[model samples]
Target: MLQIIVAMMLFFVMMFGIGFILNMLMKTTWFPIYLYLIVLLPLGIYYTWDDSMNFAQNMGAYTIVDYLPAITALAGAYISGTAIRSLRRGGYKMF
Candidate 1:
């Protein structure tokens, strides 16, 4: 349990760092989300292909749930950073 917690913390920290750098360079929330997915999707496929094949043989389908954590982490970091910047600029409306 502790290991899992630590792993999650590390994952979020890494994601946030990447998002922060991208945000700083690009200054766009949506672009970071796209960049994160583009980078992670192939890596996720490479890592999970065998497991997903085995599971698909039995379950008739594979799902995106395996990649949700990383995706969510990137998105959350991007949104959080964007929100912080917006708040600092006195533009709180996200819509």
Candidate 2:
């Protein structure tokens, strides 16, 4: 519904902006994606995991509504990295 669309956009913009800033400050191309995959994802899953459900069942419980925002956020992180890489290739030293 409208809420899902809004959440997806919000997550995408949040990730993009944060990743952009982090890349600029840390001078790293893909760190934000790594951070998202390695840190944020695990924490989120762990926090939401159900003790009664098996791993597969728990994972399978996520619908398109639940996954869309995460997918968009990941896309945002990847795009930010590509943007920084292009900027570096274009000879912008600060980025």
Candidate 3:
């Protein structure tokens, strides 16, 4: 329960941070910033877990699945930020 809560909190923080950055860099038009934020997270978690699993196996270490959410949050923030920047440049905003 605590882990889940923490993960959600992290996700929101990351999303907001990216949003702020994008808002500053973007010009204004039709890009789906929220869509990007929502979609990229799962991909990030999957990739991170896959890589982490491989690394742990090689090192003879172990891990729990609880870490994936945090990874997704971090990666989601980054992907969202980049997407926002691209969209802004492509001319998507409300100015």
Candidate 4:
């Protein structure tokens, strides 16, 4: 339980850091989303493959839920970064 919490916190922090750097470099709202999906998807899959396989073996199937945390974290970071950028650019209201 604690480990999971720690892992999630770390994940969020790392994603935020990456998003910040990407935003600094690309200066676009959408590019980080594309970059995160393109770069992290394969890496996430590769890293989680063993755990996913074990879960499938035990539970008889694997589901998208298993990967939701990573997807959500990446998305949250990207959205937050984009919102920050927009706020900086004087787009106060979120829409």
Best by TM-score: 2
| lDDT to native, each model | 0.62, 0.94, 0.55, 0.65
* Per-residue lDDT of candidate 3, residues 1-95 (tens digit): 78776776777577656655655556422223444546664565455454535755633442344455645555555555676667667886642
Error of 3 at 59 (Å): 28
lDDT of 1 by residue, 1-95 (tens): 56555655666777777766666667665665676678765676566556535755633444444344665577567765775576548854432
Best by lDDT: 2
Tell me how far the alpha carbon of residue 17 in candidate 2 is from the true structure, in angstroms, after superposition: 0.6
* Ranked candidates, highest TM-score first: 2, 4, 1, 3
- Comparing 1 with 4 on TM-score, the higher-scoring candidate is 4
Give candidates' CA RMSD values in order: 5.3, 0.8, 8.4, 5.5
TM-score of each: 0.60, 0.95, 0.38, 0.61
Candidate 3 residue spans exceeding 4 A from truth: 29-39, 45-95
Tens-digit lDDT string for candidate 4 (17-69): 77766666666666666767888776756665666357557344445545546
Residue-wise lDDT of candidate 2 within 60-79, one digit each (tens)?
Answer: 98899988999999999999
